[model samples]
Target: MPPIQLVVFDMAGTTVTDQHEVERCFTEAAAQTSLPVSPERILAVQGMGKRQVFQMLWAEQLGEQHPELERHVNTSYAAFRHILETHYQTQGASPTEGCLDTFAYLHKRGIAIALTTGFYRAVTDIILEKLGWLDGLNEQHVGTSDSLIQASVASDEVAEGRPAPLLIERAMHLLGVTDPKAVVNVGDTPSDLLSGQAAGVRLNLGVVNGTHSLDQLQPHPHDQLLASLAELPAVLEAL
Candidate 1:
C-alpha cells in the first residue's frame, strides 16, 4: 500500500543461480561424515540454514538425546562449509536471469533492495563479492541507497532462518522499512514463500526456475508465482 518501499529477496535460488551445487555439496558432506541422511531429505530443506539442516537431519537419524548428535552435526556442518565454500570460490556465482535488470528497475524507482539468504555470512559475502553486489555495503552488510543493494541478511545473522520471519524482518529493519504491506518477498523455495507469508509482506512470490518447480511450490502460500525475476518488474508495476 505504501508503494513497495523495500523488496526482500532470497539469494541462492532467487537472485543467484544455484544449479544444485548446494545440494551436491550437502550430499557429499553427509556421505563423508556418515550422517546417514538421504539426498531427498536434504532437498526437502533447501531453504533452511545449512547448519540447521545438519542438526535437524542428524537429530532425526540419531535421536535428539543421542550423545553423539552434536558431534555428528558439527562434523557434517563443518564438512559442508568447507565443500560449499571451496565450490563457490572456485566455480564462482552468477545472478539469476534478469535479476540485475529487476534490481535496476527497483533502483530507478527509488525502492530499496535487500537480499536475505539461508547461507551464513562468509559464503554470502563470497557470492555477493563475486557478483559485485558488495561494493557499497559496510562491514555490517548494510548499504546506502547508492549501493547496488541496500541491505543483506545472512541466516547466521539471525536467530532463525526460512519459514521464520526473522530474516525478512531484519532486512526491513536495516532498510528502515516499517510496513509489511510495503514489502515484496521473492525466493525459489517453499520456505521462502512461508517466510514471506509469516512476515505479512504484500507479495509472497515463488520463482519456478530455481530449486523447485511450479507444482512443488503450488501448495505453498504465496500472493503470486513467477517464472523468474524477469517478470518482477511487470508484477510490481501492476501493484
Candidate 2:
C-alpha cells in the first residue's frame, strides 16, 4: 500500500470533544423557531452545515417553494448560531482523548494533518482559538509550521458540506497533497465516511467515540471502524 500523505479529519465530534452540544443547539433553535424538528431527526444530520440543516428540515416541514421557507431557515439558523457561539464561549473547547497524541504521532511521521468541518469560519475559528490551535497558523497559507494540524477547511469556504467530496478535495489542494489514494479521512459521521469514499481516499475510517456509535456508523461506507482516535496510530502503522 502507498504511504499516506495526508489525513483529513472532522472537527467537532472527531477531534474536538462534543457531548451532543451541537445537537442540543440545533434542537433548541428549532424549538425557538417553531420548526417542530425531532431530536432524532436533528441527530441524523449531525455532519451537515448548520444553515443547510435548517434549510433541509424546514424544506421537509414546509415545501421547498413555500413563501415562508427562507424566512424560517434564516431565523432558525441565526438562533442556532447565537446559541452555539454562547455555548462554546462559556463551556470552552477541548480536544478529544488521544487526539493531540495522535496528531503528534502523525507529525513525527512527516504526515500532513488537515481538519475539515461542517461549521462556518466564525464558529470554526472560535473552537480553534479556544483550543489554542490557531496560535502558530500562517494567515497566508492557513496552516501552521509548528501546530498539530497543518490546515483547516470550513463548510463556508466550499459550495457544499459533508457527503460531498468538496471539503476533502479543498483540504488536499491547500495542503499540497496530490494523490487521493494516499489520503486517509477519519470522522464520526456517515456523511464524513461518504465524503472520503466519494473522494476515493485510501482509508475512510470512522471513530465511534463521538456523536455516533459503532452501530450507527456500521451502515456507512468505511474501510475501518475504530473505538477512538487513540487507535489510529496503530492502524496507520499496520497499513
For model 2, residues 1-239, the per-residue Cα lDDT tens digits are 57899999999989999999999999888889899978888888988888888999999999999999999999999999999999998998999988999999999998999999999988988999899888767773266656777888889899999899999999889877889999999999989999999999999999999999999999999999999899999999988
Clashes of each: 0, 0
Which candidate leads the pack in lDDT? 1
Q: Give the runs in model 1 whose Cα sits over 4 Å from its true position.
A: none
Q: 16-51, model 1: which lDDT tens digit per residue? A: 998999999999998999878777777789999889
User: Stretches of candidate 2 above 4 Å error?
Assistant: none
TM-score against native, each model:
0.98, 0.97
TM-score of model 1 vs. true structure: 0.98
CA RMSD per model (angstroms)? 0.7, 1.1
Give the CA lDDT, 0 to 100, for residue 76 in model 2. Answer: 92
Q: Write down the lDDT of every candidate, Cα atoms only.
A: 0.93, 0.90
